[model samples]
Target: MNATDRTLAGLLSAALSDDPSRPLVTYYDDATGERVELSVTTFDNWVAKTANLLQDELSAEPGDRLALLLPAHWQTAVWVLACASVGVVTDLTGDPSAADLVVSGPDTLDAARSCPGERVALSLRPLGGRFPQPPEGFTDYAVEVPGQGDRFVPYAPVDPDAPALALPDGSELTGAQAVERARQDAAARGLEPGSRLLSALPYDGWEGLSAGLLAPLAAGGSVVLAPRLERLDAASLEQRVENERVTHTAA
Candidate 1:
């Protein structure tokens, strides 16, 4: 009965078909004081468009590792889902050597450039409308989202056992393993489609990549991302829990 029982592409196709009007994500920007909510239909379309860009613009393929250096913003969400749809390896890291393509904010560009790979750095500034000077050898993310249609050009089916992400501990897990872990957790907790989860952490690495991005999608739930915390304070976390109405919290 799980909605995400099919492949990531199938899960998205289901979401687009059945509950296109449902609110898939809600973005709350503390800096700009803006709130943007997207429905399932729009969310699916954007993911498809981003998938095309990753394959066409960035030269990403099913087995290639497309790194994501994004924060807990909307664009991060889009690329995470897009990578899943096409069976590309999405290795989330701040370290540029770990990725084939990197998407990030301005501050990390220096660190990103040092490692040297096929990088695709992006700006978070334009998302807020106060466009900062972009890093050299990067692309404009603002100009990238528009001008693409909603159709997801299907690719060859992927092996469920294929590696989808690389871990920091030099460990690699297959896509089936990832889905099984999520399924086990969800069944233990009685979770299903429409269940809400609060990502209580950053999405830049192994723990974040597994629990924050993949698990929620595998469980057919919306993942609510928390702001990057330089320091994790008890009181601040409690407030976030109350604000986000987090059904399940993972580190």
Candidate 2:
């Protein structure tokens, strides 16, 4: 795809098309205390299936607010991409009541349910964890939504000028601006298309989404997400950068 046509979703689709078996994100889970590797093709499938569910089952519109309250991990990766694919506005902040739908962990699901302002809510069970009891009056996120296809029925292309995401403070950002920022950041770091990125941050914020993942994907590069590394100091960050040969490393 040309630079003009590149997007986070588009680049991921292209990468999987060329090398479905390529590794996307690899990390260890503290809950299971085990190492896990997620491939591009598998990750794409999760994104596709979840995107279809978001559009068909949840009836999410292109700009509808969707919140996530889980820990930063592969599931976060899937939901983030699903939101991008279907044009659902992802709200990463833990406040579930402020959203049309929410994906949250077992611990926070009860507190999330106490506020009844949400249109629909889904409790997100992290991988390797027991399906925790959903708070009263809440729904399990795993139930297949009716009419959700096995594959995604690509959502209509969103208006580039329309707001694609909402910040914790309720501020919004346009799709065009998000794309432009990703491109610009990659260019500034001399990490254009084909560069590789290794990020030690969570996708729960703009820095992780734009600079760490989307920017690299938009530029025909790849990102390896290492969530807990955020607690690392500057020395650790530099060590990772050198070992990974990461062209662009951001906090």
Candidate 3:
């Protein structure tokens, strides 16, 4: 990211323009036996579709609160960026009762049911498929997102100073603030343009969020996010680092 880049969305735009074919997010879930890699163009497409679903279908606004009851997987990264694109405040704690919208995974269905506003559920299956049976009082994200335009045009201008992320600690930061913080953290972590970081952190707080997604983007780097890193043996992880050309590791 450059001096002019202020928000997470701007970082993505820069990445897409810089190298659309570069790998942006590579994910692995040992428990589910899932592995997926998304190039800059593909990641942007998913973000566009997800943003459309948030804006058009869920009526999400720039200042809306979105609780994500998801893990540190590829789809979660997509949702975070989508929220950033729409200027929505992403709450990782996923407290449904306090959010304007909640997107839940299979394990958190019951918790998400408590959310009073718009609720969407994902199967978190291969290719980010929809639930086999729709949850009550909730829309299926996979079913609705495909029809959204590949390109996203926000209906309103999102102020960079508006709050973009809310952590469970009751702390919040604007888009610009988050970007600045991520840049600092990225530098501290020795990430630079085109650097590939292999991260094994949950997406539950600022540290994890920064390492797994925001910081790398702010640094114009990519990530190989291991959601179940502890399950992978040392040899396996070493092989992964070699295969993915990981330049750094965050445990």
The local distance difference test score of each candidate is 0.64, 0.65, 0.89
RMSD per model, one decimal: 3.7, 4.1, 1.6
- Flag clash pairs in model 3: none
For model 2, residues 127-246, the per-residue Cα lDDT tens digits are 433344534565555555333555676558756566666666657766667777778877776676557676766666777776556777666666756666655568966776676556
How does candidate 3 score on lDDT?
0.89
TM-score of each: 0.79, 0.76, 0.96
The lDDT-based order of candidates, best leading, equals: 3, 2, 1
Prediction-by-prediction clash tally: 0, 0, 0
lDDT of 1 by residue, 1-251 (tens): 34234455555566677667866665555455555566778778789888877777767778877656677676677877787777787666635765667766666677667545555556665343423565567766666656555676735565667776666555766666666765666666566787766654666565665455556655676666554432446886677667766677665
Q: Cα deviation in Å at residue 225, candidate 1?
A: 2.0
| Model number with the top TM-score | 3
Clashes of 3: 0
How do the residues 1-251 of candidate 3 rate in per-residue lDDT, one tens digit apiece?
Answer: 45337888888999999999999999987888788999999999999999999999889999999999998888899999899898899998758998999999889989998888999998889878778888877898888989999999889867788999999898999989999999999999999998999989889999988999988988999999997899988898889889999998888
Candidate 2 achieves a global lDDT of 0.65
Best-performing candidate as measured by lDDT: 3
TM-score of 2: 0.76
